[model samples]
Target: MKPPIAPYAFIAPALLLLLAFGVLPVVVALLVSVTDLDLAGLADWANVGFVGLENYRELLADHGFWQALANTGIYAVFGVPAVVVASLAVALLLNRSENRFFRALRAFYFVPAVTAIVAVSLVWGYLYNTRFGLLNHLLSLVGLPPAQWLGDSVLVKFSVALVAVWRGTGLNIIIFLAALKGIPREYLEAAALDGASELRKITSIVLPLLRFAILFVTVTTVIAWLQLFDEPYVLTKGGPLGRSTSISLFLYQEGFAAGRFGYAGAGTLVLFLVIAGATLVQMRARRFDADH
Candidate 1:
């Protein structure tokens, strides 16, 4: 009994830190979401009376918040799946032929993931500049009109999405490559014996086995997209008539920039719930397939 108690005691410190740092902040934020707290009232703890979800009500009525929500949805819907497919294709290519050049190629894909996002955004902004940009220069060579990549309201969101796809596709490729390698060679040989083509074997064997990895990639990518901030914040600044503003950017502006702390908290909470629910649905679908 004493030995068992000692092991439990050893785990207590880390658990306490997790509770303090992770759990407590979430609870406090939930409480803050129900109030009318602003920067001027920050020091007045006693005045922070519960307003019983008026912040949530206000968010529902706010057109700016709704616009942000729509932009975020569009980003997630288009951007995440495009990244997933591109990454999977790259991973499939790299997982084959263990040549030194291919090994180097694997590393090359991940360089963007480890690079500073602000620096990457700055370089991309220059490339997206209407007049002197590399993208426009190439298009000019082909006699196409120089289109405003980041400046036009209609094209800004798609431009931001393209940047996101470039940066995000690498991580998912690495994950899918690892999963592909984990697949046993015996299955490939067996499929070949049955006169199965590469495409048929991949469809029948490889994909079924890689389901979990695919599910994981999809869920995590969706979660990241839901919390999209840095790229849009740095590149577009929610500009071109607020066409590229995501929910997270909107929340940041409301909470910190405008000092509408409670309303921002409410927006944050709504985002949390949306991500949580979406993840749960994906997990449940996976569970159902496993059961079947």
Candidate 2:
């Protein structure tokens, strides 16, 4: 039997693009990670000397790196569940109606996902402003003290993660809505005949049927939160004593700002491993639940 040439030809362009953009960069970064690559090395390849595991060792010892890792963890922990639950909830609400107004509301919910992060940050910046922002102004009207949303160290992580959660929920809501639509209407109709309440039908039948969708959304949301960067970068710049600095932002600062390409490459590799490991764990857990 011969392999199908047509199938390979069909996928070849996509495969080539992935190799060039995705796989090639990681390979180059891995190679660069073992060398003392910096600004000087960029100008002259001869300046890049082999320094096996040196950057990794330094990264392991660096307090800033550890703090960034912790901050990234915090962001993921806060954002992932919030995004998943909010997206799922919104999707369920949207799924309830096929009305034109509900359809319009679906698009409205998705606007944040398609909007540019820079623009979203600018709008959120005004909302977080202490002196004249709407949020603080509203607080004053309610006889509550105004909060320093982005300036307070403890509040900054949640503040940054909240923006990301808001932006993130939009796409996941669409994903969940699609999944919700795929569910057979007959199942719910039958459940209603059996005297099942809406909540009961959702808890018993709908939820189990939607397990695969939930897992998909959860895994992707987790990966996205793990790579948290944009919201914090635009809003906080990882300020308030680096409280909002994610590992990605930390790597950006190291690689671009400080001109430590090799060091940042090591961090990048570690982040890749973390994301892969987390994904694998989630997959395995889902499989285990499916089997038993």
- Per-candidate TM-scores read 0.93, 0.98
Best by TM-score: 2
lDDT of 2 by residue, 114-211 (tens): 99999999899999999999989999999999999999999999989889989999989999888888999999999999999999999998889889
The clash count of every prediction, one per candidate, is 0, 0
Query: Ten consecutive residues with minimal summed lDDT in candidate 1?
Result: 1-10
Best by lDDT: 2
- Please list all clashing residue pairs in model 1, or write none if there are none: none
